[model samples]
Each structure stands twice: as structure tokens, then as C-alpha cells.
Target: MLDANLSTQLKGYLEKLTQPIELAASLDDGAKSAELESLLQEIASLSGKIAYVRKDDDARKPSFAINRVGSDIGVRFAGIPMGHEFTSLVLALLQVGGHPSKASQDVIEQVRTLRGTGSDGVLRFETYFSLSCQNCPDVVQALNLMSVLNPSIQHVAIDGGLFQQEVEARQVMAVPTVFLNGELFESGRMSLEQIVAKLDTGAADREADKIRHKDSFDVLVVGGGPAGAAAAVYAARKGIRTGVAAERFGGQVLDTMSIENFISVPHTEGPKMAAALEQHVREYDVDIMNLQRAQKLIPAREPGGLIEVQLANGASLKSRTVVVSTGARWRQMNVPGEEQYRNKGVAYCPHCDGPLFKGKRVAVIGGGNSGVEAAIDLAGIVNHVTLIEFDSQLRADDVLQRKLRSLDNVTVITSGQTTEVLGDGHKVNGLVYRDRLGGDSHRIELEGVFVQIGLLPNTEWLKGTLALSPRGEIEIDAYGRTSLPGVFAAGDATTVPYKQIVIAMGEGSKAALSAFDHLIRTSAPVEAAVAA
Candidate 1:
């Protein structure tokens, strides 16, 4: 049941309901069922437009469905939709009750016209998730909204922790593992646009057509992380046409667990911060192209000609100046059995996948801040945590190192390099590591292996086009000027000294200014020649 303060807030939210909704619960005589029934009853009391009913017909107990009074379109929940899923529950209620979604009209139309995969022409999706996962809510809410929009589409969000047997049998070692038509659909975090693109095969062509017709921009940003956002904002403030082509808005920041050193803001979550960045960018005149991966950069032929940036979707965007803030991604161990067992006990995100290994032994591979932090976090949930470092000593801050040493269920191993992930064909059961000084191989039985190695810059596409450092980072000058004419680079993708969110933002802003300066100085002669 919800607390009084929560009830009051929920009541206020429920007041937005324009139509009557019903909760059809399938439960049994168990503690979780009783708790769910109480929660449902309490929710029903919040608004007269809501009703709760019990039915023990579903194969999964302690489950419920949200539906409008007279519609077949609905969403289902196979466990208590609390914790991270609480927002998903609220969104389902509002969406089912006729409240409009915040998604773009084009995306909404795409979802509404989707035909489920299969000969049956119906779609049934099941997503396994965990309460502690920060990435699961987006998948659950997106699917629930899709079900509400299309009558033939039905989605049920299942809690992996509550359904332990199913999680083990299916080898669902990660949160947000989605299945469609009883077959594996996708695993890991996904957005509404991404889900629709997967479900509708022909969507790519239509999207590509739309992107191809976009007008040239004055300043185009090729990423949507902290750096790209800052560049877009700075360019837009100058009253010039700006567009951001990003693989995913927020980039690696979306996978971050906690951020406390952002200056001014003492504490914030990654997703929340990402949302704020997107919202702030939206307030400007900048045009955002999400899920767009830059494939190649072709500089303009002339001094003031438009530069072309090719995309992975066979489309391209032209601009007078470009800011490359493509950012970086988590580096993998790349050892044998790592890729084979990914999402089957080998994961890169401890925050997203840690809860699945509750009470199990796990290994954290790395020696830096991220590895130490992941080990400390996993120690609280898992039965045991073994922190393995390639270096002789941990590189984390003194405070963090001190805190890690104080944990009772944690073990630290220095001068260790992860050799291989050991797993059966189904899932991981152990890991192999070697000592640097002793030159001895050791194998430890564990259920999960969380890789917290460093990051790899997203600069492969620009390899032959511009100057790059030995480590594959884009080479830039102090003013953020890249080797290419009229092109600038920023953030983790560039040769900036430190890699931090705040630093990325400042670098992005500087890059945008440099691009603008380049634009004005270069375009004057071209305009003068044309006038003559």
C-alpha cells in the first residue's frame, strides 16, 4: 500500500483521467497477492473514475491489467509495479485513461500502424525487468503505451526478481530483456523510437526518406551527449540553424549510475540529467535527430561550401560547420566467452544488471573509479564481490578506496588481469584471471562478471578523414578546431585532457563558438563574390 503522502500525489495525478479505467487483477492467497490487492484497492480509492476487480484466471499470479471501461486495448503487469516501475504504472494508467503521450506525432503514427511480427498478425510482448534497474522503465512504459494505442498489440511487463524460475530458465541475466511472440526480441535499454523501428521493418526506408530531405544547417552537431547539447544550445542562441544528429541523446551518460561532482548540482541521476538536457535543447530552435549514427564526414569542396555528414541509415545531413561530440562507450574485456555470454551473466552495466545476481557471487573487472564503485555497489546486494584489477594498486580516490576496504563481503585482488569468462553454453558459471607478478592462473566460480574497464572513443568513422591520436581520439586545437576545415570536435571523442561531464559541456560550448567564428570568416568572401 502507498503512504499517505504518496496517495495524495497519486490522487492529484489521477485527476487528469478523462475516462473511466478498470484494474483486472489475477491473484492468489499469498503475501504478495495480498499486498498487491491492498495497493490496487488503495489506488482505486484515489479516484472515482478507477475500479479494481479480482480474477484468478491468468497463468501468472499477482498480476493485473489496465484497461479503459469498454476497450480491448490494454497493458498488463505480472508483478508489483513499484520502485523504478512505479512511473511505468502511472504512465500506463494515464495513457489508458485517454491522456495524450509526449512522443512525437510521427512516432505515434508509426506505433499506431504497426502490425505484430508473425503470420497471426497479432503482437504479444513480454519484458523481464528488475526493480533496481534504471533502464527498465523506459522499455516497460514504451511497450505499455504501444499496447494502449494498438488493439492487436498486448504487452506484459514481468519482474525478473519475482519470477526467479522463469528468469533462470530463459537465461535473462540482464534487465529489460524483451520477448516478442515467445521469441527473444531484444535485451538492454531501448527507446520508443527504437522499439517501433524494430517492430516495423519498413520503417527504416520511410525514416531515411525523411532525413534525406532535411535542409542544410548552419551549425550541425554530431552527437547528443553533454557536449553535443551544449554545442546545439550555443549555436541556436546565435539565431542560426542548428541540428543534432545523435546515436542516442545522452550517450554514455545514460549508463552512468550516480553523478555528484557536476558543480552547483550536488546530486543527480544520469537519466534524469539526460532528460533535462534534451528538454533544455528543445526550448531552443535546434532540430534534434535522435538514433542517428554518423558514418562518415565529407568536408566541403570549397572554403565556404556546405560540409556533408553521412549517416548509417543511408541518408546524409549538410551543414556549413560541424561539431563532433560523438563521445565514447564502455570498453569490453573481449576475452573468450565474454561476448558469447553477454546478457547471460556477462554485463557491462552493473547498475542495470546487478539486481539479477542478488545473493550470488560476482566479479568486477577493472582498477579505476568505475570498477571500484561497481564492486562497492554490488557488495550490498550480491553475497560476495571480488574486485579484480590489472594494475598493482586501485586507481580510485583515497575516499573510495577506504570505503571499499571497509566492506565485509568484498575481496580485492591487485595485479590481476581477466583472462576469460567461463560459462556453459547457456550461462556463465565462473571466470578466469591471471596474476601479473606471480604468473599464475586462477579460476573463481561466480554467476556474474561486470566489466568496468575504461572507455573507447567513438571516432572510427572519422579515422581517414581527420587527424587522430594514437589512441584513436580526434585531435583538436585549443579553440576546438579539428584538422578538417570548418570542423570542430569536443568531449571524450577529442584530445581534451580530462573526461568529465562538466568538462564536456564547456568543450562543446567552445567548439560551437569556434565553428561560428569559422563560418562568419569563411562565408564573407563567398557572399561578396556572389554579389559582384
Candidate 2:
């Protein structure tokens, strides 16, 4: 059943549909058919322009299609579109019911051109997703929009939870795992442009070789997180040529669920914040190169020389100054069975995967702030939470520890080190941990395990090029200046004390100002005189 707020929002969005959107469910004695049927009926009740019907075709059981009154859009969902994927269903209805897609004009044109030699050759997209994955909806929505734009492309989103056999067969270790034409296309969140580019070339590694050129800019900001986006905007405001290179915008922000620490804003969602960041950056004249990953950094041979940045795509960028803001990522325990059961039973983000384990016992691995906080958060959603820590005492704040102690559904275990992840090759069923104080091993039966240890900086790519702290973070001075001249660093990638959105934004501003000062002082007298 739809809630009050969600029902109102869906009704408002559905009002844009000029034509009736028909939802057809194939119910042939499948386990999920009744559930899907109920969901469709509830959705159809939300708006007058929506309708549902039962089809006696030979299509996949429990599958559904969104049609524009009389025509099928070639888009289908082989699993229930609940949880985070509910947005994908709404978007599909809007797009097929005469509402324009949210994708850019270029992406729409690219999808249209994928119709190869008539409709005989079809572009089949199989996206594997979890109900709780926050990033899964983006991938599903993008592929679904492409299918709506071009009839030659057919897209089907498969819930990894429902089809465990297919997931194990395909070895889908992560949510939003996309397979194009029966081949693995990508594994994580990707921009629409990147998806289209990969689909056009039929090769994920082709972009790096195809884009072979040296791009020069006055300031080049690496990473597309909050820090890098702020730096680019600030630099561009000074009327300088600025560019940004990132594998994906939003960085860890995309994984974050509800953000309350950000100043001025009391609360916000991760995707909303990420969209706002991208929108703010676009307001400036910054050249954003999404899906472009920075590979190597070559410092200037001499003073006033150009610093070269090599990309994984084989493209090079030269800039007078560079700002490194590649944020940190979740650190894995690297124990046995960890990799094998990544998405099966082992998950890094508690916010994104917590809902999937509702009413089921789960374990949070760690005793630190993140771990304890995760336990406290999961206590309300799950049936029970087992909190394990490697240290004798919890490293979380007193307030968090007190809050954790107040929860009845949480069990705390100290001096416990994760030994192995327990899974049945298809899904995680339990885990093994060792007692550090006593030479004994213990096991806990849980449906899911959330790794909440700490974060690892995204600075491995700058190993020999820049000075790093013992913890592998970039070392920087107060002005956000790194060890290298004409270079600066900020955000979680650097040795900053705190890792918050507001802190990262301030550091980024500082780094941009420092770089601008360096440029003013290092410029030739003739060029400086012209400005004077």
C-alpha cells in the first residue's frame, strides 16, 4: 500500500501523462505474481491516466510491461519494482505516456541511433539490482528511458534477490550490475553518456584509447565529489579556464542516504544532494568530463612548466595547477569469503542495504563510530543487530555508545575480529569471528553483514607523485597545499581531521584560492602587466 506523502507525490508526477499508461502483468502461477498484481492495482488507483490488466501471453511469469494505451514500449521488469526501484517504475510510466524523458538531447539521439540495420538487431539490457541499493534506481531508470526512446532496445531489470540462481550464475557481486547483449557492461553507478558510449562501442575499454589528446586548462580539478565540484565552481568564478575529470560525479555522496550534518540544510537525501552539486557546477563555465578517470600525475619538470595528468582513457590533460579531491571509499575487511559474498550477504553501506534485511537478524562489523552508529540505526529496522568490534572498547562517541546501549535489539561484542564471511555461494547465511583476548572462535547466524570499519582514501593513484600520510591520505598544509608546488589537495583524500560535506566544501574553497594566488604570482610580467 502507498503511504500518504508518497501517494500524493506519485499522483502529482502522474498528472503530466497526457495518455493512459497501461500496465500488463503475466500471471502464470508464479510466486510473485499476486504481489505484482496488487502493486499494479495500487499504482493504477493513484491516477486516472493509469490502468492495469492481466495478459495471457507466453511472456515471463511475474513480469510486467508499460504500454502507451495501444503500443508496448519494449520495456519490461522481470521482478517486483519495489523499494528504491519504485522511482524507476514511475519514470517509465511518465516517459511512455507522452512525457519527455529526463535524459539530455544528446543521449536521446544516441539511443535513437542504436537501431542497427532495422529492428531485427535488438539491444538487450539486463540490469541486476537489489531492492535496497540506492544506486540501482539510476541505472534502471537510464536503461528504461533508452528502451522507451528507441524500439530496437529492450531493457529488463532483474531483482537479484528474487532470482538468486541467475545472480549466482552471472556472479553479480554488486548492485546496478549491467549486462549488455549478455556481456558484463558495467558494475557500478555510471552516467547516461558513459552508458551510451559503451553501448555504441560494445566495449568498455574503447573510450580510453579513442580519446587520445592533450587537454590544457588553467586549473584542472580531479574528482567530482563535493570538494572538487566546489573548487571548480570557485576557480571558474575567477574567469579562468577550469576543467574537471571524474569517473563519476557525487563520489561517496551517492551512497549516503540521509545527510543532517550539512550546514543550513537540516536534512537531505544523497541523490538529491548529488544532483544539486552537479547543477551548481553546471552554472559555471567548468568543463566537466564525466566517466573520465585520472590515472597518473606528472609534475612540472621546471618552474612555470605545465603539469600533465594522464587519464585511464589514454587522454592527457595539462594545467597550470591541479587540485586533488578524490574522496575516500569504504574499506573492506579483506577476509576470506568477503569478496565472494559482497552483495550476497556482505554489504558496505548500511543505509543502502539495511532495508533488505528488515525483520531479519544482521551483524555490524566494527566497534568504531561508524559501526556503532550503523548498529543503532539498524536496530529500528531489523529484528536484531549483533555489533562486533576488534578492539576491547568501542571507539564511538559517548553519546553514540549511550544510544547504542539503549537499544534492546542490539548485542555488542568487543575484542572480536572478523575471520570469515559465511555464505552458501548464493547468499550469506552467517559469519565467523575470533576473540582477540581469548583464543576462541565464535559464529553468528545472520542474514546480512554490514562492514562499518572505516574509509580508505582514494589516493593510491598518487602513491609516488605526492606526499602521503601513514594512513595513505594526501598530506597537505593549512592553505590546502600539497607537498608538490602548484598543487593542492582537499576532502577525505587529504589528511583533514574531519570528513564532512561542509568541511570538504570549505577546504575546496581554500584550495581554489591558494591556486589562484599561485597563478597571480607565477605569471609572466607581460601577462601580469596586461591585467594591471
Candidate 3:
């Protein structure tokens, strides 16, 4: 049951319901079942338009579904949704109870038009998730919203921790693993638009067409991380037509778990910060285009002319000034079998996927702060952890190194180069490494491998087109101007010295101002340009 403070807040939300709703539960006499029943009863007591019923029909025990009265539209939760999934449960209740959703009208209409499962047209979705996963809620809420909008679509959010047998049978080693029509649909965080586009084949083309018809912008910002958001807001505030195109809003920051270094904010989660950034960007007149990837950038033929940026969706957006803030992605170990065993037993985020390997042996492949932190975190849940570092000494802070050494279940190896990832053709079995001092090969058998090496810049697309440093980072001047005139770069993709959220935001603002200066100097009227 919810605490007193939470109950009051949930009661306030229940007041928004305009239609009657019922909770259909399939439970037993187990402790979890009793707890779930109590929770459901309490929820029903809070709202006048809600009712609860018990049934023993569902194969999964301790499960319940929120259904709209006189309709088949419903979304289910297979276990106690107390952690990250609590929001999902609340949203499902409100949406199914006839409370208006905040989703855009176009998205709601698109979800309503999506075809359901197979020939029967009954879309049954199952998502296996863990309570500790920060990314799972997005996937759960998106699917739950889709189910609420389309009666033919039904979704069940299952907790992998509660249902161990199903997790094992499905070989689910990641959070937010989704299945549609009893087959693997996708794994990891997904947005409503992403799910709809996948479900509806023609949705992509229709969206591409819409984006293709948009007007040219005065400032076009690529990427949607902290840097891009800042750049877009700064550019739009100058009374210029600003636009932002991102593959996914939030970018690499979404994968980050805890962020304590941001000034003025003592402690905050990555997802929360990303949401705040997006919200701040929306306060301006910037045209936000999500789920769009910039493939290439074409410089203008003449100075002060339009710069065209081509997208992967075959849409091109022209702008007088361009801000390249494409952030970096997790650096992957390209050793043999690493890709084959990915999601099977290899993971990049210990915060998100560490729970999946509870009581198992795992290896952390790095020596920096991230790797040390991952090894220390995994040591608590996993049976044993082997921290492999390419350097002879750890590069993490002295405190972190001291703490890592204090852990009983952790083993450290230095100057060891990962040669190959050995797997059993399905999941990781071990990893092969060579010691730098002795030049002897060694293999450590482990169930999982968490790679925490570093990040690689997303500047591969801009290669040969702009001035790049030896490390592939965009070379920018003090003013954030790149080799190409009117093209400004910022954040991790640029040679900004430091890769931090606060630094990125400052760099983005600087880049936008630099672009504005470039515009006023070169793209202004003849007399005004000369005077400036």
C-alpha cells in the first residue's frame, strides 16, 4: 500500500477521472498477492469512479489490469509497481478512467490507427522489466498509452524480478525487454512515436513527408542533449526561427544514471535532468523534431547563404546558421563475440542491467571512474566482479579506488588488454585477455560483461567535411566556430577540453551567440552589415 503522503497525491490525481473504471485482479493467497490486493483496494477507495474485482484467470499471479468501463481498453501490471513503474501504474489508471492524456493529438490519432497483432487483430504486448531500471518507465508508459488509445491493443508490464522463470526462459538479460504477439519486439527504452512507427509500416513515410515540407529555419540545431537544448533555446530567444532535429531527444544523457556535478542542482537523475532540459527548450519558439537523425551537412555555396543538413529520413532542412551538438555514444569493445553476446550477457549500463545478473559473476572492462563505479555497484548484486583495466593504475579518484579495493567480491587486473569475448553461441561464457607485463594470455570465465570504457564522438558523419582533430573531435575556435563558416559546434563532439553537463550547456550557449554574431555580420542588409 502507498504511504500517507503518496496516498494524498494519488487521491488528488484520481479526482480528474470523468468516467467509471474497474480494477480486475488475478491473484492468489501468497504474500505478494495479499499486498497487491491491499494496494488495489486502497486505490479503489481513493476514487469515486473506481471499483475493484478479483479473479483467478490470468496465468501470471499477483497481476491486475485497469480497464475502462464498457470498453476492452486496458493495461496490466504483473507485479508490484512501486519503484520506477509506479508512475506507469498511475498514468494507466488516469488515462483508462477517461482523464485526458498529455500526449499530442497527432500521436494519439496515430496510435488509434495502428493495426493490432495478427489476423485476429488483438495486439498483446508483454514487457519484462526490473524495478531499479530508470529507462523501463518510458517503455511501459508509451505502451500503456498506446493500449489506452487503441482498444485492440493490450499491454502487460511484467517485473522480471518477480517472474524469474519467465525471465530465464526468455533469456532476458536487459530491462524493458518487450514482446508483441508472443515474439521479441524490442529491448531497451522506446518512445511512443518509435513504437507506433514500428507497428505501422507506412508511418515512417508519412512522417518523412511531413518533415520534408517544413519551412527553412534561421538557426538549425542538430542533436537534442543538454548542449542542443541550450543552443536551440538561446537561438530562438533572439527572435530567429530556430529548429532542432534529434534522433532521440535526451541523447547520451538518458543512459547516464546519477549526476551530482551539475551546479545549483545537488543531486538528480539523468532522465529527470533530460526532461527538465527538454521542457526548458519547449518554452521557446524552437521547432522540436524528435526521432530524426542528421546524416550529412552540406555547406552553403556562398557566404551568408543557406546551409543544408540531410536527414536519414530523406528530409533536408535549410538554415542560415547551423549548430552541431551531436553528442558522443558509449564506446564499445569491438572484440570478437562482443556484438553476438550483446543483450544476451554483455551490457553497457550497470545501473540499468546489473540487476538482471544478480548473484552471477561479471567483468567490468575499464579503469576510469565509470568502470570503477560500475564494478563497485555490481559487486553488491553480483556474486563476484573482475575489474579489468588497460592501464597499469586506475584513473579513478583515490576515494573510489580505496572503496573498490575494500570490496570483498571484487578482483582487479591491470595492464590487461581484452582480446576476445568468448560466448556459448547465445550468452557470454568468458573473456580472453593478454597481460602487458608477461605477454601471457588468460581467460576469466564469467556470466556477464559490462563495458565501461569511455565514449566515442558522433562526428564520423562530419569527417572530411569539417576540420577535425586527430581524435575525430570537431575542432572549434574560442568562439565555437568550426572550419565551415556559419557552422558552429559544441559539447562532446567538439574539442571542448572537458565533457561535462555544465560545460556543454555553456558551450552550447556560446555557439548560439557565435552563430548570431555571424548572421548579423554577414547575412544582414548591406548598410547594416557594413555598420556592424
Best by lDDT: 1
The weakest ten consecutive residues by lDDT in model 1 span: 523-532
lDDT of each: 0.92, 0.84, 0.90
Off by over 4 Å in 3: 525-532
Better of 2 and 3 by lDDT: 3
lDDT of 1 at 346: 93
Give the lDDT ranking, best first. 1, 3, 2
| Residue-by-residue lDDT tens digits, candidate 2, 1-532 | 6788988898889899988788888876765888888888988998888889888563556778888787657478878888888888888888988898756676688788885433578878899887877788888988888888888888899887777667667766567788877887787776678678866875345545544453577788999999998899888888788888887898889888779989889998788799899999999878887888888999999997788888886678888999999999999999999998887778887765665566779999988888998999889888999999999999999999999999999999999999999987788889999999987999899888999998999988899999999999999999999999989988999999989988998998889888888888886422322363
TM-score of 2: 0.85
Q: Which stretches of candidate 1 lie over 4 Å from their true place?
A: 117-119, 524-532
Model 1: how far residue 99 lies from native, Å = 0.4
Candidate 1 local lDDT, 369-419, one digit each (tens): 899989999998899999999999999998899999999999999999899
Q: Candidate 2 vs. truth: CA RMSD?
A: 4.0
User: What would the TM-score be for candidate 3 when compared with the true structure?
Assistant: 0.96
lDDT of 3 by residue, 179-244 (tens): 998999999888888888788888778888988899888789999999999999888778788999
Candidate 1 has which clashing residue pairs, if any?
none
